[model samples]
Target: MGQGQPRRHHQVPQFYLRGFADDSDRVKVVRFGEQPRTFVTSVKNVAVEANFYKVDWLDAVREDLAEKLIGKVEDAAVEPLRLLAQHGELTVQQRGDVATWVVLQYLRGRGKRVDSVGLQKLMLRADLALGGKQRLASRLGLDDSAEVDALWDSIVVRGELADPPTMRYSHLRTMFSSTISKVAAAYVQAHWQVVTFQRRRLFTSDQPVCLWRAPDDDPGVGLLTADAVSIPLNHTTGLVIFPQIPSGITGESAPTTQYHRWFLAHTWMSAEELLILHPDDELPDWLPAYREARLGTLGLPDIQQFIDIGEAWRTHQDRSQPAAEVSF
Candidate 1:
C-alpha cells in the first residue's frame, strides 16, 4: 500500500518465466479461446494481476506479506531450478528447495484460489442445510429472527449469499504451511527427470504446473494421485516427476513414455492461457495432440462410461434378486 510497493503480483514467478523468454526478455504469448491469437510481450507484463497477493485487512506495512514470503521461496529455488535445467543434477537440499517451489507454484495460483473459495462456499452451504435456520443464525451471530429468515432465503432458496467467503492471503499462507510439507514430500520422493528437447520446445501458461493423471486413472486427481507432474523449466527443458519405480517399468526411458501419456490427458482453461510462453523456433512436434488435450478432447474413451456400465449391471443384478424388507 505504500508508495513504490508492488501492486501487480505475478502468480507465475518472473524468474521462472524468464526461462521461456527470448534474448530481449520478451515472450511469445499465444492466447487461446474462440478467437485464439498470438502476440509478443515482456515476461513481466504477463501472468500478473493487480493486488493479487495483497492482504487487504492487514496494515499497509505488512500488506505484501504473502508476496514477500513467496519471493523468498522463489529466491531459494532459483539456483536449484537453474542447476536442474542446465545440468540435470541437484544436491539433496537443492532438490528439496526446488520441490518446495514447485508445490507452491501449483498451490498459489488464481485457479487454486478460486477452488478454495468454491470449496469453502460448498462447506458453508452444507453446514447451513444440515443445521436449521435458527442454529445457523446463532452460529453466525445473527440475533434477529428476521435476519435469519432472510439469510436462509438468500442462501438456501436463492443459492446466493450476500457476503461470500473469500480466501485471503493469510488463509493462503495457512494452507501453504499445512499442506506444503506433504505435497513437497511427494515431489521429493518422486523420481525427477530433466528432459531437454532439441526437436521440440515446451510452453507454459499462467497455471504452469501441470498435474497429470493417466487416462484410466480415477477421476479424483490431485498431487498425491497424479500419475505425473511436469513443469517447463525453459523452452528447451522441462522437469517431469513420476512415482518411485512403478511396476513393470524400469531404466531411464520409462519417464519419457510416461511424459507423453501424461501430456495426452492434461487440460487447461482458455482464460488461464492468457500468457502462454513458447519459443521463437518452429512449431513443436505433437502440437496437434497438445492442442486437442488443452481443449480436453483428446479422443480418449471416457472413464465415466465404464463406471456407468458397472453401475447399471449392479442395478440389474439387484432387481433380479429377491428383495427382503426389515421392520423396525
Candidate 2:
C-alpha cells in the first residue's frame, strides 16, 4: 500500500450493518450475492466498501405512493399541491400526511361519505404499519402536542397490526437484486448508459453478470467495481418499504413477508429510482383524470369511472398491491 495507490473496494459478498431504529439497537445485517451470508461483525467492518446513501423519504412519498395513485392521467388543477410535494421538500412525516389527504380527497369526490373520524383511523393505521407518527394531527394541520401525544398513545395501543416476517441478509440481498434488475430494464433503452447482461463464468449460475458502459470521462463508472453494492436507504428499503400485511386468508397470524425467497419486493419504488424524482418535472400523463376525479370537477360519469376503478383496485390487490409485496 503506497501513498499514490488507490484504496481497494471489497470484492463480492458485500456486507453491511444497518439499523432500523438506532445505531446500537434494531440493527439489520445486509449482504449482496446469489445468496446472502450471515456476518457476525457489524456493517462498520466494511463501511469503506461503498458510499453511504441516505434516503429522501419525501421523494419516496411523491414518487412511490402519490404518483402511482395518480397514474398516467394529467391533472392541471392540483398543480399547487403537486408542486408542494415536488419542491417543498417535505419530511417523511409530512409526506405521509399529504398522501392521506390525497386519498381522502379522492374517496370523497367519488361520494364515499368520508369524515374526519374515518380519516383519522385510516391515517393512524397507515402510520402504524408504515412506521410514521402524528399522521392524523399532521393531516389536520394541528400542532398541538397534547393531541399528537394522545393519538400516538392510541396508535401504540392498537398493537402491531401487521407483523413483519423474519428478515435476513439473504432476503435483503435477493430483494435488492430484483430492484436493480428492474431499474436496469427501465433504463435499458435510455441513452445515458448501456448495461448488458450475460452469463458469467462462476459457480453461482443463477446470477447473471452485469456489464455497464459510461462515457469515458464519467466518474460514476467507478460503480462498476466489485465493491459497489446496494445499501438500505433508511434501514428499510430506502425508496420503498412495506409492512407485513396480513394475507387475505382469515385467522392467519403468521405473516409471510416474501412468498418466494428469490422474489422479494417492498411497498414502493426502489432507492435507485428515487434519485431521478425531480420536483419541477411536470406531472405524468395519468394524474389529470385522477385530480379531476378527486376534486369532483370531472363529470358525473367520469367520476363514477374513477370510483369503479378504485373499487376494482381495492378488490384486486394483485394489480394495486403495495410495491413491497411485489418486490419480495
- lDDT of each prediction vs. the true structure? 0.67, 0.27
Q: Point out where model 1 deviates above 4 Å.
A: 33-36, 132-154, 162-166, 215-217, 244-271, 279-328
Return the top candidate by lDDT: 1
Range of the 10 consecutive residues with the lowest summed lDDT in candidate 1: 289-298
lDDT of 1 by residue, 1-328 (tens): 7888888999888899889888888887766556676788898888789988887754678878788888989999999989888764577678779888988887787666665555555556655664566667888899899989888777754558533435665347654685888877767767877666665555677766777676673565677777777777887677777754333221233335555434422423322555455547433344431332132211333333433555566668779998798799
Which one is best on TM-score? 1
Candidate 1 residue pairs that clash: none
Cα RMSD (Å) between model 1 and the true structure?
9.0
Backbone clash numbers for all candidates listed: 0, 21
